[model samples]
Target: MSVVVSFKVRREVKELMDKYRDRVNWAEELRRFVEEKIRQLRAEENLAEILEELRKAGWSVPKGFSVKSVREDRDSR
Candidate 1:
């Protein structure tokens, strides 16, 4: 399913957008931009929730744990 979204803009802004519309699909461009931003924001929120859950479970790194270990772990993947 799909929905329509509309917004108001200044006359100059609309004029500039119309001018660029001749060279690009501005509506599709805005849709992609909006979708990417939405995904990024949702990911951030999910990460924050996961961190909170970890904190609630008293999860913590030991004093001996270092960024080197973290980097190595990531590189292993």
Candidate 2:
């Protein structure tokens, strides 16, 4: 089922969305992106153990830096 929803976008966002119009979808696109990322991370070496080590060391990640986002950027190139 398809439903319509509305939200406000700033001028720059509208420009970028138009620039990438072919890649834009409101619903399942984000879900797909997240799912693919999870799959890729699951193949990494000792990912869970590394996260536990970070937690134990108390070396907090910088504000607004997501591990998934970093992985996606690295994989994109």
Candidate 3:
């Protein structure tokens, strides 16, 4: 099943799209873009929830812990 999505665009935008419409599947491209954005938004929301949980649990990094230091430590091992 498919749904129709209709939106108004500037005349120039419409014209530009029409010019390349035959060269591209615009609707499919738009669908891909929308799907990727949706995934990104959901990931961000999940991360926010995790951060809130961590805050409630008083999670904190030790003063000596740093990404660079950790990388060096791992490299030395």
TM-score of each: 0.77, 0.31, 0.80
lDDT of 3 by residue, 1-77 (tens): 98998889999999999999999899999999999999999999999999999999999987867987988989999
- Look at candidate 2 and tell me the lDDT of residue 68: 77
For model 2, the stretches where C-alpha displacement exceeds 4 angstroms are 1-11, 14-23, 46-77
Per-residue lDDT tens digits for candidate 1, residues 1-77, read 99999989999999999888889898899899999999999999999999999999999988868987988999999
lDDT of 1: 0.94
Instruction: Per model, state how many residue pairs clash.
Output: 0, 0, 0
Ranking by TM-score: 3, 1, 2
Could you give candidate 2's per-residue lDDT for residues 1-77 as a string of tens digits?
Answer: 85555668999988888788778774567568767998888867478888888999997968767977888999999
Compute the lDDT of residue 71 as modeled in candidate 3: 89
The true-structure Cα RMSD of candidate 2 reads: 13.9
lDDT: worst 10-residue window of model 3: 61-70
Best by lDDT: 3
Give the higher-TM-score candidate: 2 or 3.
3
Identify the leading candidate in terms of TM-score. 3
